[model samples]
Target: MDIDRKKSTYLTLGILFMILLSLIRWGGETLQYLFYLRVPLISGALLFMLPIICIYLLPSMLGNLFVLKNKWRMSLVIPGAVATGLGIVIIGGIIGTNAAARFNVSPCPLLEALLQDDALTPYLFALILAFPTAWAAYWSSGPASKEMSNTDRKIGVAIGSILSLLLMGAIYWARTGETVSWVSDMLLMIISILPSEARAGLVKDDQLTPGLVTASAFLAVSTILYLIGLLLYRPKIKKDRWQLPALSYVLGLLLIFSFLFGLLTFVLDYYRVPVLLSFLAVSALAYKLWKVDHYYDIRPTPTEPPKPDDFIGALKERLAHQQGRRTLVVVCASGGGIQAAGWTSMVLTGLQKRLGKDFTQAIGLISSVSGGSVGTLHFLDRFGNEGAPEDSELNAIFNASTEDSLGATGWGLVYPDLWRFSGLPFLHTQPRDRGAAIETDWKSFMKSPNATLRDWVDPIKQGKLPVPVFNATIVEDGRHYLISPMTFATEPLEGLEFNRLYPQHDMDASTAALLSATFPYVTPITRNSEEDDSQSKVTPVFHVADGGFFDNFGIVSAVDWLNEQVLPKRVELEIERVLLVEIRAFPDEEPLQTASRKNVGFLMSLFGPLLTVLAARNSTQAQRNEDIVNDLKTKWTAKDIDIFDFKISFPKNIPFFEIPTQTGYENIDQYTTALKDEKKAYTPPLSWTLTKKQKDAIRNAWEILNQDQSSSVAELEKVWSRK
Candidate 1:
C-alpha cells in the first residue's frame, strides 16, 4: 500500500516536472529577449510569436516522430517539413534579393554582414540562447509526438529560432530609413502573416471584372456554409449527423453557385473560368463522397478465444457436432500438400488394404484460393474471421497452385500428355446446356470397369471433337500422327500448329510419356486464378512450368471423391491442417536489346533501377526484424505455433511492488489504514492468475522460510521457483 502510494506520488511529480520545464523555457525566452538581448519591444513581440508557432507545431511533430519509428514511413515527415521550410525560405530570400536589385540596394545587407563577421559574436549569442530554449521546449514535448527524434527536436527548435531571427532582421532592414508608411506597413504585415493570400489575385486587369465579383460571391457563400457545416457537425446517436452529409450540403450549395456562374458566363460569352470551376466542384464532391462510402464497408472483427481443451478433446468435440463436411489439403499442385496427403493416404491405404475396399467412405476436398495467387481471398471469403472451424464435418482443405497463364497453358498441355503417360480414361460429362453446366455431375462420364480401353481411348486417340474420349490426337503428317493427346472435355486450339510454337521441346522422355498417357483422361479445371495471371506476365514469368495451378473446379470434384469414395474405401487418412507458405517475387527485368552489346547493357541498366525499387518495396526489414524477435520469444515460451498471444505468465514469487517494506515503518496499520480510510488511495484491484497447487505451495514456502511471517530473501527465492 505504501509502495503504490509512493508510485502515485512519483507519477504526479513527473507530470508536474514536465509542466515546469515548459514554463521555464517560455519564461527564459521572454525574459532573455526583454532584458539581456535589449532588442526593440516590437522585435521581441514578433520573436515571442515564434514560440507559439513552435508550440502549435509540437503535436504534429511528435506524431511525425512516432511514424518515423515505423520503417515504412521513417524520415518522411522531418524531411518533408525541412524541405518545405527550406523551399519557403529560399523563395523568400529570392524575392528579397530581386526586390533589392530593383531598388539598387542590398535588401539583406545586415544578413550578409553577419555571415561575413569573423567573430560572429552577436549571432553566436543568439544561437546559444535559442538552441537551449528550443531544446527545453522540445524535450518536454517530444516523447508525446510522432516522428520526433531527440536530435531532431533539438535541431528543430534551434533552426526555428535562427530562421525567425533572420526573417525578422530582413523585415527590419526593409522598413528602415523610411517614413514608415502606415498603409504599406499594414499591407506588408498582412502579406507576411497571411502568405497564402498573396496567391489570390482579384483584379489582375486593374478593373472590377465580373470574374472578381463571382469569386467574391463564392468565397462569401463558402465562408457562411463552412460556419454552418461546423455547427451541424456534432456527435449524435444517429449516424446521419456525421460530417460527410454536412460537407455534402455545403458542396451542393457551392455546386449551385457554380452552375449559376457558369450559366451567366455563357450568357455573357465568358465561359472558361465558370465552366472549369463548376466541373471541378462537382467532380471533387463526388470523389469525396465515394471515398466516405468505402470507409463504411468494414470486415468483421476477430472472435474470442477458443475453449480450454487438449487437441484430441477439441477435435472430438468439433467432429461430434458434424454440422458439415469439407476437405483440406496444403495446396493442389504443390509438393507440401501432396506429400502430406500422400503420407496420410499411404497410412490409410495400409489400414484399408487389410479391411478391403468398402471399409473407408465419405471423403471430399475443400478447394481454397491459392495462397500465392491471392492471399486476401481466404481472409475475404471468411470475412477475415480466423477461429476454430464452426462447421464440424469439414475433413480437409487444400491450398492449390495459383493459376497463371503458364499454369493454364500448362494444364492444357497436361491433358494431352496425361493420356500417353498414364492410363486414366477421360470422362466428358458436359450438360446439355453449356451455360448451365454443373461440375458435380462430371462423375457420370467415368468409364465403367467393363468398358474396353480401346473404346474409351478412341475419341481422344482420333483427335475427334465433341466426343467423349480418353485421348486427343492431331495428324501432322501423311503418316498417322498424334501431336498431343487430350481428354474428352478438351477445348481444341484454333489455327494452333500442334507441336510447333512453344513446342514440347523441353519435356524429358519419361515426363513426355507420362503426360501422353494421362493427358487423354485429364481435363482442364478452372479456379479463381485471376490475380495470378496478371502477375505472371510481369515477372520471372509466373507459369504452369513453375508449378502454379489454380484448381477451384478440380477441388469440388476432389472433395466429392474423398467424401464418397476415398473415405469409404479407406484410401487416405485425413487430419485438418493449415498450409503455410510465403510467395513473393521480384519484378521482371527489361528485355535486353539485341542491337549491340552496349544497347543490351543500357537496357539492363534501365530495368536495374526498377528492379531495385521492386526489391525494396517487397522487403519487410522492419516487420521481419520485429517478427523474428517475437518468433524467438514465442518459441522460448513454447507458444510459437499459436501465432496469437492469448496468455501471459507472471512469476508467483515476485513481490507485488505495491507492498511497503520500509525499515522504520512501525505503524503498518496507520499507513495502510490511511490509504483505505482518509486519502482514498485504492483503485480497482488488478486481476491475477495462479493454480491452487501453486498457491498452496507458495503459502507453505512463505511460512517455512519466513519464521516471523514477514517477507524475506529466502521466501522470495522459494516463490520464484514455482514455475
Candidate 2:
C-alpha cells in the first residue's frame, strides 16, 4: 500500500514539473507592471552570455542527457527536457501576448506590456546572441563539435567579461540608497524579466527599470562559474565523479535558482503537499495496476553501528571513572538555520573555554536539531584537541556555510534533481541533493573523529566527549528522530530513534546534523529504510524532515535522557548536580494574548490551520520543557542533586553597515552605540549561504551574554569547578 521510496522522488519531481511550467508562464506575463515597459540595453548583454547557460549550465550539468552511446536515454532525456522548457516558454509568450493578464497585484495602472507581441520578441532576443547560442547549441547537441570553437570561446569571454563588468558597475552606480535591501531588490527586479521567474516577493519586489540590465550581471556570474567549472571539472571527475564538478555547477545554479525561485516561490512556493500526495497516490495506483514491485535502491545506504556496543553502559562506565560525583551537563541546541549554528558554536566553545579540561567530563549529552547539529560538528572539529576555538574558527564557519549551500541546492532542485519525473533515476549516479550541498562546506571543515556521527561514539564512551544527538523529525509522523550512535528516548516528544529502527544504516555527521533542519521546499526530504521485524523481507522506508517541526528547542530528548538515563542512575553513578545548558538561537517571543498570532490575510485564513498547529506545537514545547525543568527541580530537590538550567540566547545583529570587515571588533557593544543603527530583523538568514559580514556579525554578537536571566554563569562555573 505504501508508495515505493524511489517513486516518491518521481512524485515530488512530478509536482515540481507540473507547477513549475505553469507558474513560470503565468508569473512572467502577469506583469507586476510596477516598472515601465522598457527595451533595456542589458537584455542584449544576457544574450551575449549564452555560452555559459547554453553550453555549460545546460550541457555540462545536464548534457549527460545527450549521452553519445546510449540511444534510449538520449531519445527520452533530450526531447523531454527540451519539450518541457520550450512548451513553457511558448505558453508564457502566448499568455503574455494574448488575453487580459490577471493581476493579483494592484499597485499601478496597466502600462504597455512588453510581451503583447512576443512572436517577434523571442526571435529578437535570440538573434542578438545567435552566434554564441548557436555555437553552444551545436557543440552540446551531440558529437558534432566535441572540442568547441576556440573563436566562439574567445568571443564569449570578451563579450561576457566586458559587458558583465560594465553591468555590475552600472548596478553600483544605480543603487539610490545605501541599504542591503536596495541592491537585493534591484537584483530581484532585474531577475523578474526571466521567463521562469514570475511572481515576486522575497523582500520588496516592485522593481523599476534598469533592473532588467542587472540580468547580465547575473549571467556573468554564471559565465564565470562555468569557466571555473570548465577548468576544474575535468580533473576531479576521475576521483569523485559527478560530485565535485556538480558542486560548482550547483553553486552557480544555486545563485540563479535563489533569485528565480525566490521570485517564483511567491506563487509556486515549494509547498505542494496536497498536489504531491495526489501525484503519489495516482502513481501508486498505476504501479499496482501494472503489477510493478519497484526495487530501486540507489539512495545512499546508512552506515552500520559499531560492533559490541552498549552506548549507555559505556557512557556510565566512563562517567564513573571520574574520581568523585560531579554536575552532569546536558546541552539542548535548537534548530534555527545558521542562527542556531552561530549561537551553538559560540556558546559551546564559550562553555568549553570556561570549563577548560572539565568540559567533556561534565557534559553528559549534546542533543541538537538541524543547524544546531551543524554547529555541534564544527565545535568538536575545531575545539576537539585545542580546548577552545580561535576567533577565526568561530567566524570561518559562518562565511563558509553561506553561499556554497543555498544556490547549489536550488541548482539541484531546478535541473538534475527534477529528472526523477522521467524515471531516469540512474542518470544521477551520485547524489546532487540539498543535503549533499549542505554537507560540502561542513565536510571540508571537519575530519577524523568529528567528521561523521559514528566517529563521535568511541570518544564519548572513552570518557573524552559528550554524546551528540542530531534530532530529525519523521516526515510521516512528525515525531522526533534522533540520529546518533546510540538510540534516543522519543516518548513524550514522540521521536523515532534511527539507531534502533535502522541499525544497519549509520549516518555521516553532516546528514545527521541537517536531517531535521530541512526547511520546507528548500531542503530535500531524506528517505531511510529498514527491514520489517515482523515480516522477513518487508523493508519499509521512512521520509524525515527537519526536527524543528516537532521541537525546535530540542529539549524533549535532553529531558528524556536526563529522566531515563542520568536521573535514574544518579545514585549508582555518584552524580551531583544536573546542569542543563539550553542554547536558544531566537530571542524569547513576547508572550501573546491568544493561542496563535492573528493573521488576517485570505491565504492565511485558508492555509493557517496547519501552520497555526505547528506554531502552537513549538510554543507549547518551549513551555513543556520549562514545566519539566520545574518538576525535576521539585522532585529531585532533596536528593543532594541540584538542577542548574542555564539558557543562552544570541545577541542582536548589528545593521549591515555596522558589521565590521577586517578591522577587529571583538564584540558587538565594542562597535560603540553611535555606529549601531537599526537592529537586523532576523539572525543571519536560515539560508545555505552566508556573507563575511554576517559571519563576523555572528561572532562579534557572541560577546553580549551575561547569563543573569536564569542560573548565573558564575554559579554554572561553580558547578563546573565542583569536581
Candidate 3:
C-alpha cells in the first residue's frame, strides 16, 4: 500500500473503532442498570437515557459542528443517531452479557439501593419528558440546524429558549436531588487519592469537606477561561510563549470528571448517583476541537498494498521445502493474554538460541492465537532480514510486549477517546477500545517504527521472514479468520480468508497482532464492510471477534494444514518429516471433582446455562485442538510420511511458592486466622499490559521450568544435535 492508503486505513479503522467503543461504553452502562439489573421499568428507562445523550449524542453533535461540511447532511444522520441510540439497549445487552461472563462480574447491588424513595421516583415523569425534549429543542436550534433559513432558525431558537427556561424550572424543583451526594462523593474520592498538599480543605478533623475548595482541585469550570485557553493555544505565535498550553486547565478539569466516572464504574463500584447527572454546558464545548480528523483520516484513509498470496504460494520458497529431506516445523501457540505472549516469545527465542540456524531454517510457519499471535508478530517484526540473527532483536521486542497497555486503555475507555469516538484529539490521542488502545499503545511503544504488514510480503515470499498466522473468529459464522502474511489454504480449511474477503485494506501491524487477542468485551468486534455499501448499514454487519473464542490454542488450523494441505499434496510439494510443536500457557489438564450448587435463584436460573457455555468456550476448543493433534499423530504415524509432536508447557511453577501440608487448624479461630494469613497466589493477570512486578514474576518462568517444559526443550535440543 502507498503511504497515503496506509494512513487512511489506520485513521478510518481507528476512528470507527473509537466510535464503536463509546457505543460499547454506553451499552455497558445502559445494560447494567436497565436490563441486567432489571430495575423497575420506569426507573430503568430513567437510568438509560443520559448515557445515550451524553456519551453518544453530545460528543457527536459537538464534533459535527466543526466536521460536517454539508450542514444539511447532518439532518440525515440525526434519525440514524436516534435510532442507533434506541437500538443500543438490545445490542449493548448482548455485549454486556458476553463481558459479564468473561470477567465474572455481577453489577446489581442490594434491593434497598434500587428501591429507595430518593433514588428516582419523584423526578421520574419530568425527567422522562424533559431530557428528550431538551435534546430535540437543542438539535433544532443547535449545530445540526445551522443550514436552516433565518425564519426556521429563529423559530427553533424560540422553542429552544422556552425549553431552556422550563429545564431551569425543573432543576429548581429537583434542587440538589442526589446531585450533591453524587457530586460530593465523587469529589471526596478523587481528593482522597491526591497528595495532601494538593488537596486544600479536603479534610478537617478527619472528615472530608464537600465544598468547592475540597474534593477536586481540577474543577475550575469557566467559559471565559476555556475561551482564553483556546485563544492562547497558538504554538506558532510564540513557540515557547509558555511551557504549558493555557488549554491544560480545561483539559485537567475534563480529565478529572472522566477519572471520577471510571472510579465509580470499575474501582469504587459505587453507582448510587440517582440515575443520571444533567449535562454540563462546559463539557459539550470543551473538546470540540479535540478531534481525530481523517488526513491522519489529512483524509486519514489508511489502506494496504495488494500483495495478497495464497497458502501454497507462501510456502513455495521456504528452505525447508527446498531442502527435500530435512524435518519441517509448525508451531501452535496458546492464548493467555500477555502472559501467553511472554511465554510464546520465550519459547521461540529459546528455540532460535538453542537450535540456532537449524531451528530458523527448519521452521515453516507459526500458528498462533490471541497473545501467542502478539508474541509471534513481535518475533516476525525484526525477522524480516535474514542477515540479522533470528533472536538478535528479540530482547527489544519482548520488552515492547511487556510495556503497559491496560493503564492507558482503562482511562482511554472513559475519557479522551469517548469524547470524539472516531477521531483522536487533534494532538493524536490513544483509542478507548481495549483492542484499539492496546494495539495503538503497543505500536507507539515499540522502540523503533514497526515495518508495516505488507512491508514483510516480498521478504516472506523470498524466504527471509517466517510466516506467522494469527486467527480471529467470525461471529456470524463460527470459523477461524486468518491474519497472515499469506492467506490461508482455503480449499482445505473451513474458515474465513481475510485477504480474499477484504483485498483492499491493510490492517495496522498492531491491529493484526491483537485481532486474535481482543478476547471477550476487551475491544470492539471488527466489522468488515465497504465504505460505499450503504446497504450494509441495515444488513447484519460482519463481525470478527477474538480468535481465542474459536481456538485458544491455534492447533486446529495448524492440524488442518497438515491434514488437508500437506498430507494430501505431499508429493507435489517436496515431501518431508513434520514436527508439530504445541506451546501452552496452562499445564496439562487434571480431572477434578465438581462442586454442587447449594441454591439456585432467578438470575442463576436465567444465566446458568449461559455461564456454563462461557466457561466451556475455551476449554472445549482447547480439547478439540488436543484431540486434533492426537488424531493427526495416530492417522499419520503409519502413513508414507514422518511426523512428531513436541510439547512445551509454561512452567507450572509461576512466581510464588506452593506447598502441600497435612496439618489442619484445630478450631474456628485457628482456621479463620490461617485464611487471613494466606497469601494471594501469583496468578498472571489477563490484561493487555503487564507491570514490572508481573514481568519480574515471568522473568524467572524458564528458571522454574516444569518437567514437561524442561523435557520438551531437552528433547528438541537432542533431536537438533543429531540432525
Judging by TM-score against the true structure, name the best candidate. 2
Query: Which residue window of length 10 is worst by lDDT in model 2?
Result: 34-43
Each prediction's TM-score versus the true structure: 0.19, 0.59, 0.57
Per-candidate local distance difference test: 0.26, 0.52, 0.52
Q: Model 3, which residues run further than 4 Å from truth?
A: 1-218, 221-316, 320-324, 387-390, 420-434, 445-450, 491-493, 534-541, 596-607, 656-682, 706-710
Give lDDT tens digits, candidate 2, residues 153-195.
3443455345434533433343333443454556666556645
Who is ahead in TM-score, 2 or 3?
Answer: 2
Ten contiguous residues minimizing lDDT sum, candidate 1? 292-301
**Residue-level lDDT tens digits of model 1 in 1-723:** 479978997999999998768756873433322221122222223222333342233322111111122211222222222222222222222222222322223245432233221223333433432332233234323332223455665555555555455533433343322333343444344434433323122122332212222223323433454445334432222312222211122123323333333233322222124544555666556546542110000112132211111212322222332233312211111111212222122222221233222211111112221111111111111110122211221111111111111111222222222221222223221121111111111111111212221221222122221111111112231111111212111123321111232222221111211111211112221111122247544211111210111121112222222233333322122332211111111111234455344434557678878766544533433244235435433543352121211111111332211122331235543654432222222111111111122223223433343343342323322332231
* Best-to-worst TM-score order: 2, 3, 1
Model 3 Cα lDDT, one tens digit per residue, 73-123: 223223222222222222222223232332244433332232232333222
RMSD values for the candidates in order, in angstroms, are 28.9, 17.0, 21.3
